[model samples]
Target chain A: MTPRARREALTGFLLILPWGLGFCAFTAGPMAISLVLSLTKWDILTAPHYVGLANFANLWHDPLFWMALRNTLAYTVLTVPLSLAGSLTLALLLNRRVPAVSVLRALFYLPELMPTVATAIIWTWLLNTHFGLLNYLLSRLGLPQVAWLESTTWALPSLVLMGLWTIGGNRMLIFLAGLQGIPEELHEAAALDGASRGRRLWHVTLPLLSPVIFFNFVLGVIASFQVFTPAYIVTNGGPADSTLVYVLYLYRNGFQYFQMGYAAAMAWVMLLLLLAFTWVQFRLMQRWVYYEGGATPG
Target chain B: MRSKWTSVLVMAALAGTMWTLGGGSPAQAQKVTTIRMVWQGEANELKLYQGLVSKFEQSHPDIRVNLETVVASSDPEYFQKVQVIAASGDYPDVIYGHYSWFPAALAKHFLLDIDPYLAKAGLAKSAYFPTAIQQFSDHGKLYALPRETSSIALYYNADMFKQAGLRTPNEYYAAGQWTWNTFLTVAKKLTRDSNGKSADQPGFNPNAIVQWGTVAPVNMPFGLFPVVYSFGGDVLDPTNTRCRLDRPAAVRGIAFLQDLLLKQHAGILPSQAQQTNLFANGKIGMMASGYWDIVVTGSAIKTFAWDVAPLPKGTIQSTRVATGAYAIPAKAPHPDQAWTLIRFLSQPDNTMELAHLGLIIPALRAAALSPEFLAPGKVPLHRKVFVDALAYGRLDPRTTHWAEMVDTLGSEMDLVWTGQKSPAAATGEACAKIDALLQH
Candidate 1:
């Protein structure tokens, strides 16, 4: 390479050095260590002893591990689709040329801005059995009050209901962008062809938005699978471990129980599962996720 | 020439920075050591601690302190924060922690053995409550200087009892009629629906009940285990090598609580137990909590009258005692300074300052028994019950596997609380799990 070319490349490399060093030290470094520790019994306090695949073998029999996995899977399944549809609906409404549309968009996105801890705290009062606003409203509607959090049957679902609070967040914004990106001519053509608005949405708008939906779907599954904070702050995997998500259990093993090896194994398992889920989604994408251009994958 | 001058200037600046960081000068006498002392508390407590630290700094000019606060909702969470900090090789000079993490901390040798320091300070074990010192020790070697001791008691709303024409818990205890049965009866009377039907009365709608009789001791150790002990049950066998919670006595104790929760519907679920100002709102007639709540809940209550009473007699009168203390990390960079800070914090005067907030029963025996702590004309009117409790109070089960055992028990207990599983079955399953943890 020419001296000038080499110099320019060197300068570019120097510019990214800070971030590169940070990624290695903070992220990659710990990850590599955790991978090693996953094969050992390290409690952060004591010296770790290499135990081969013992932690993984233990996880195979750990009832709580399976329970946490089931709970997290249930949460992800419930959250992702509902969130996808909810965000898409909000995006559709926000995509309209209504007056003060920006204000409407901001209002819809406000819940996402609140800190997770604050949201969890607020929801505790909102879901209080007797004095809760939800129960009070239910009573007014001539319905029996539901124990939103106290009962095991309802605790997980209550968390899922909370998960809906984030539907109008970034996912909606992305959907809005996708809605805007849909060619205006298609809608005009559909209308000219005497297709109803609903038909136009289903046939044209939805098809074009499919790729965005797919993107958000993949992201939502990964995000929801790692749900931790609300569960930690609110129920804390309680009312009978109903709200015990994967990460929460992993955290308990690592931090609370001081079984770092077990927690690390759980983390790796989660990473593998998430990768598999995403890969499967990609494998299934050809059937539904439409590409407007001819650059669609096999 | 300019580049060489810049390099020289850089070297001078670096030297100056190093010199300032290295205690100003090498020849300086009475070099100050800034010890990092980690602590956690609420806003008021933190403010008070800041004042106390300032006072300590004024008195010990040679010893500076960098007070670090770790915000945690629970003691175990605090332990995790310190453990993470230590794991990063940035061990704090001191940590003010609770007994909940004692076994784990002691097992890992995370704490410096304060017995030697206490000897150097000429402090005797008899100066503190025996339980306080015992909780901080293992095999007679103390690892922490006790800051405060706490005991659980029954907090009852007096107006509710008076309006119901029933004697208060303290009155019952005075007459020796304060067993679990009478406690349940009183709770039933205190509990009322919007239509004024108490739990015992006909046509009382459990669904629409506005007032709860009690917050169930469904919460761990402090809340429930005391009742277990009072019922002549033990959490662990004498050797601390096996789980005893599945024994008949323990099962009966748990069954009693389950009855209060499910059958009578007099007790709120433990999940619903500590709702924001529930007891303070006059909606809860009785609640089981530690002495710490005197400030936490009492300060919020202006519309109601309340007082402390010893927990109702089960098979025998019992309560849970626990302590919080300031411990030096084993690898502390400034161990001697940390000890000095701990000694300063645990002084009779400083402990009195801490106790005045009504947040703790000072672990210092003299300070705790003083008139200031037992405040005769206080609104609670029964502050001594906490001190009295310490006499019969049992410490929480001592096990290095505290977290795992408690989690196992808590998960099973939750099912019992929700009426999904019988107390007997749940405890049986819990013991099975806890036993596995014990064996390891």
Candidate 2:
């Protein structure tokens, strides 16, 4: 290589050196160690004992593992599409020219900015069966009270409902950005062809918004699978392990139960599952997701 | 490029110098040993601990105590932090943790065997309550020494009994008539609906209770185990290797609670917040909890007149006991100093101070029964009931996998609490789960 080219390359490498070093040291190094640790029998307080495939094998018989996985999948399946739809609906509404629209946007986004610990505590009271504001309102409307966090059947669904409160914030902002990026000419052309406003939205707007929905869908599903703080703080993964999401169970095994190796194995399995789901979503995305730049060959 | 490399080398050298300077000087490394202690407590309790540390440090001029408290939001978080600290191998010289925690910590060999220190200090197992010592020991090896011990007792709202024209629990105890049958009858009478109709009255609405008769042992095994034991059953078999929750006595005990909460409506099933301060809420006629509740109830109940009494006899009177103890890790840097601090903190005077503050019942028999501890202050008038209950108090079962077992049982028990399953079915399922876990 020429001297000038070598000098430029060396300078570029030096600039990124700190980030590269940090990634290798903190993230990659620990991930590699966790991979090795999953193959052993290690409580945090004791020396790790080599026990090939034992921790992974134990997961098959562990009823709690299966229960947690089922709860996590239920959460993901319920949350992702609903959150996407809710956020997109909010974004479409906000995308209109309205009085104090900026203020309204910030107001809607406020729940996401609040700390999760505080949010969970607030929801705990608001969901209380006898005394909570929600049930009080229902009673005022002449409806029967429903046990929320207290009932095993309702606990997971209650958490899903709690999660919807924040969808008007971050995901809606993304949807808003996606909506704004859609060309007005397409909608105008549809209208000129005598299409109804609803038809124009169905044909032009939704197609353009599909990519953003897909992105949010993938992220929402991933986030839902790792639900921890609400279950940890509010229900403690109970009324009967009904809200025992995957990450919370992993935490119980690793920290509360002191079975770090088993927790590592659970973590690895979660990562693989997430990867598999994301891959399937991406494959399906080819059929549904649309791009404006004509990037996809017909 | 050359200047940048030169500057990097200079920065590295300066960092090295700073690190070297940060190390203690050779002259500073003498016989004054610093013992690091990790503890968990609320503000007032920690202040008391800090004060005790200062006094201990004053007495032993050469020993310095350094406290590192982890303000645990919950038990699981506290255990997680302790395990992480233990894993780092930079263990504190001493740790103040729950009795339930020691079994799991001991199983993983995180805690040091305090037997040698106990021998050196000329202390015997008799120094503490038998249950306290037993709870902290595993396989005949002691890992910790009790700082305080607590046992459950019946606490009743005095005005509720008086207004209902019913005999008080302590009065019944004095008359030697405080059996479960009499207790239940009294409970039924005291329980009133919104229309002031007693539980036995026709058309009494269980759904709209104005006053609950009692608060059943709803959450902890500490609360439930005593009733089961009173009926001559236990959570685990005698070997502690298999669950005995499905035993007839346990089923009977649990079924009694289910009937109270779900059928008889003598007790209301409380929410999580209600459970914390249920006795003080004035809606319940009676509740059973640990001796530690005296402090909380004393402070919270301003309008109500309350007192404690022995838990009414079931098949036989029984209660579950628990303790908080100071343990040293296996690789602690200053074990001797840690032991000295543990010994000093557990002295009679210190224990009396703690008891006076309504923090604990001293584990030491003499201290527990001292005038300062027994004297009536702001709290329950019948504090002696706590000491009396100890005669029938049994320690919670401690297996190597205590946390896992408790969690499994707790989940199944929740089914019973929610009325989705019978006590027999829930306990049977719990036994199966626990049996599988123990075998694992």
Candidate 3:
């Protein structure tokens, strides 16, 4: 390579050195240690004896492990598409050039800025069985009041319902950005062809918005799968372990139950599952997700 | 371009040096030793400890305490954070912990033996409550110095009883009529609907009740076990090797609590947001909680007279006993200094000063029995009941799996409380889990 090119390359490498070092030390280092620890029986205080795949073997028989995994899967499946649709609808409504649009956008994004703990606290007050606002409204509608967080049947669903509180949060903001990126010319052309607004949206906006939807769907799935704070702060995985999501159970094993190696195994399983999910999502994307640059003539 | 690159390299070195200097300043050119003490307490308790720590520092000019206050909602959370801290290989010189935490910490050999220090200091074993001392000792060695002892007792609202025209719980106790059946009868009388009907009244509405009878005692050691014990049942057999909660006596206790909540509609689960601290709010007749709640709940009531009473008799009157204590970690950086802090903290005068906070019944016998603790003309005029309970109080069954066992049982108990499972079914399931835990 020429001297100038080599110098430029060296500068680029130097610029990324700090991040590279951090990624290795904090991320890669722990991942390596946790992988090895997963094969042992360490209780944090004692020496870890090699236990082969005993932890994973035990996981096959552990009821709580399966319960947590099922709860998390159900939560993710329920939350992702619902949140995506809700946020996209919100984004569509807010994308118009209305007066005070910036203010409206900021208000919609406010819940995302609030801390998770604060959101959990507010949701608890909203979901209280006898005196909460939701039950009060339900009673007004001549419906029987639901014990939102206290009943096994309703606890997990209540969490899913509360999660809709963030539909106008960051996911909506991303969709708004994606909507703004779509050229106005396409909509105008469709209108010129006498296509109705709904037709234009179906044929033009949706095709262009498919990429953003995929992005948000994947992120929403991952985030929902790792749900912990609300479950921990509110029901505490109860009314018979109905809300025991995977991460909270993993935390219990690692920190509370003195089963660090088992927790590490659980963590690895979660990672592998997430990886597989993302890979499948990427493969499926070719069918629906449209990229302007990738749409080449056959 | 060369000068720009040179300046960038210089800046990188400068940042590196500053980072190193910032983190490396703890140890310096001085003879003074700073021993870290990890503690968990509410704001007032924290203030009390800070005052004591400052006084200790003043007396021992060479020793400085770097106090680390851990904010935890429960003892298990405190232990969890401490365990994580220890696993990181940065051990605190001293740790303030509870009896429930002792078994797990001891199982891991994470605590220092304190018996030798006690002997060297000429501290007599009989100076504290036997149960308090017994809880901290294992395998013929004391691992922690007892700090404060506690037991669950009934706290009743006297104004509610007066308004209901029912005799107060203390009066019932005085008349030897305070058995579980009597307690239930009184509870039914005390519980009121918004329509001014008591729980037992023909037209009373359980759904629209404005006042509850008691805040249910359905927690671990302090709440649930006492009821189980009072019903003449055991959580585990004496050897602590197998679960016995499925036995008839325990089932009877569990069934009694379920019936009160569901069928009788007299009690409400503790920690329900709408029902929380109902005793303090003057919306409940009675509550069963630890001595610590004397201050926690006592300070909140403004409209009613409330007082302590012994837990009503079941087959027998029994309460679970527990203690909080201070110990030096096995790998403490300054064990000698930690011991000095513990010794100063546990001195009779010092312990008595802490007891005045009303959060703890000082483990020091002389201080506990003193009028300061009894607090004559106090809101809870029956302070002596807490002291009396020490006579019959049962320590939680010793086990290395205390946290896991309690959790296993608690989850099942939740189903029973919700009327989803019978007490027999819940206990049977809990035992199935706990029995396996015991084998581990």
Candidate 4:
């Protein structure tokens, strides 16, 4: 090889080395081991004996596994879009040249900065049926008190509400970046053509913001798929396992039941499902998600 | 500059590799062995344990005890984590485990058979409480050493009983009239609304009552087990290999508890957040708690007068005597040192001193009955009830999967208490699941 080509190749390898090593060690290693583990019947102690898809076969008939999956899918479907909309709405409101808009944005985003445990604790008190502030206010206004986390019907939604509280930061940041990226000339041209505010937003603002919206949607979907901590700490998958998310069940299997092999299988299944969902989202995005410059030819 | 950067990166990578590889080696070779001693206790109790460990280290210069204490809230999770570590063949020499955990640990062969050590130490089997010792033994092999034993009792608000013109629980216990029927009557009398109406009164709104007659933290399996037993129920068959909670008596026991909450409405069902605070604030009159609550809840009960008495009898009188024990792991690197620590902790004098501090009821009968440990000022007033109840206290049926059974039962019982399912239905469901679990 020529000296210049060798030098370029060496520099390229050096630049990529740290990330490449990290990817192999952290991500690839666990993925490969988990796949092997999924086929075994090991607790933490005994030697892992090959069971050959017995764990996956068990999941087919496991009622609790299906229930947990349904609950998780429901939570993700409800939370991701609702949170994205809430974030975008707040972002639009703050994008204007209002007084102290930055301060308002920061104030709105503060809940996301609080530790998850702290947020959960605060929400537990707020959502309590009898003694909670929410019920008290509702009663004062002559509205019926809702059992937020106690009733099986309300428990999952209560957790969804709690999860929504932290969306402000993510939404605000993404929206701000999207809004700044919108070309000023388009808005002025829309105004010159006597376009209404709604028209301008629908045509210019939304199309320009599609890339950021897609990015946030993908991130939100992935994060929402692994919703475990709130249900774990606050509800403990209870009032009859109504809030038992997929990851929470995986945790129970791995730690509580000492069924690590089963949990490993559940994890890989979850990864494949998420991967498929992301792929579908990307495929569907061809119709709506517009690039600023142009769509690349396939 | 390029050479310096490359060298730095290489050195960092090497250092990281070396750090990872070197970690597990030095931990094995440390001559002054650091034994991780873990237990669940209050802050003060932990402080006392630390002091005792320091004393222990002073006496044995060659060994060092690395005290690892966890709060009671995290005790179950910590126990599970430690068990996982034990399974991984890297367990501490000594561990503080609940009596219920002994069967599972022994089943897994994770606990060391300490009978030989006890025999060598000249510790007679008769020295400890018979029930406590029997609970730690499985199939003729003693797998653990009981550090303390506790019994469930009826803890009452003495001031409320007085105001309601009811006799103290001690008087009833003394008269052998502390039956479940009389207990229910007293609960109804003491259960009053803010408008000065008893549960029997015409205008009494159970939901709107400001003060409840009793509070049973229905979550604790040890507290609930006796009620089931008293009603002529058993959690498992004679061999403890099959579940029997679906039986008529067990269903009756569960139904009675649900009636106390839903039908009679004699107690408050606070939201999960309010349960602990409500009990501590004297909003509930009586709660069936363990002897350890004397340390946990007693310190918080300065608002009103509260004392414990023997739990009221059901069809057949019984109560649960739960204990926490010290066990050496089967993989313990220093078995001799672990035994020395267990022997020191289990000595009568040490047990008495510890009990006098109100940590728990000592497992040694002599230490428990000693005046220094049993005196009124040293231990709380309600503790005597636990002492009395020990005569009738029954050990939980030994099962290798007791923890899983408890989790299932506790959750199902919660459903019963919440009026979501009938006692019969919940108990039947739990039995089916438990039977499946046991088979596994």
Q: Give the least accurate 10-residue stretch of model 4 chain B, judged by summed lDDT.
A: B267-276
Model 3: share of true interface contacts reproduced: 0.69
lDDT of 3 by residue, B1-440 (tens): 99999999999999999999898878655588999999898888789889999999999878999889999988889988888889889999999998888888898899999888999999998998999999999877999999999988999888989999989888899999999999899999988898989999899998877888887778655778999999999999989999999999999999999999999999877766233456777888988988988887888888888889999999998998999999999999899989999999999889988888888998888889987678889778887899889979999988878877877888899899899999999999999999999998
- Lowest summed lDDT over 10 consecutive residues: which window, candidate 3 chain B? B269-278
> Candidate 4, overall lDDT?
0.81
- lDDT tens readout by residue for model 4, A76-109: 9999989999999888988988789889989998
> How many residue pairs clash per model?
0, 0, 0, 0
DockQ of each: 0.73, 0.62, 0.58, 0.35
Off-target runs (Cα >4 Å) in candidate 2 are A1-15, A296-298, B1-30, B138-141, B272-278
Encode model 1's per-residue lDDT on B382-411: one tens digit a residue.
Answer: 979999999899998788899888878888
Best by TM-score: 1
Candidate 2 accuracy as lDDT: 0.85
**A83-158 per-residue lDDT for model 1 (tens digits):** 9999999999889888999998999999999998899988988998877899999999999888888788898989
Q: What lDDT does candidate 4 reach at residue A279?
A: 88
In model 4, which runs have C-alpha deviations exceeding 4 angstroms?
A1-23, A296-298, B1-46, B68-72, B192-196, B270-276
| Per-residue lDDT of candidate 4, residues B102-197 (tens digit) | 666676777888899888888887777888888888767788888888888877888889888899878987898988777777887778777879
Distance (Å) between predicted and true CA of B192, model 3?
2.0
Q: Candidate 3 at B435: error in angstroms? A: 0.3
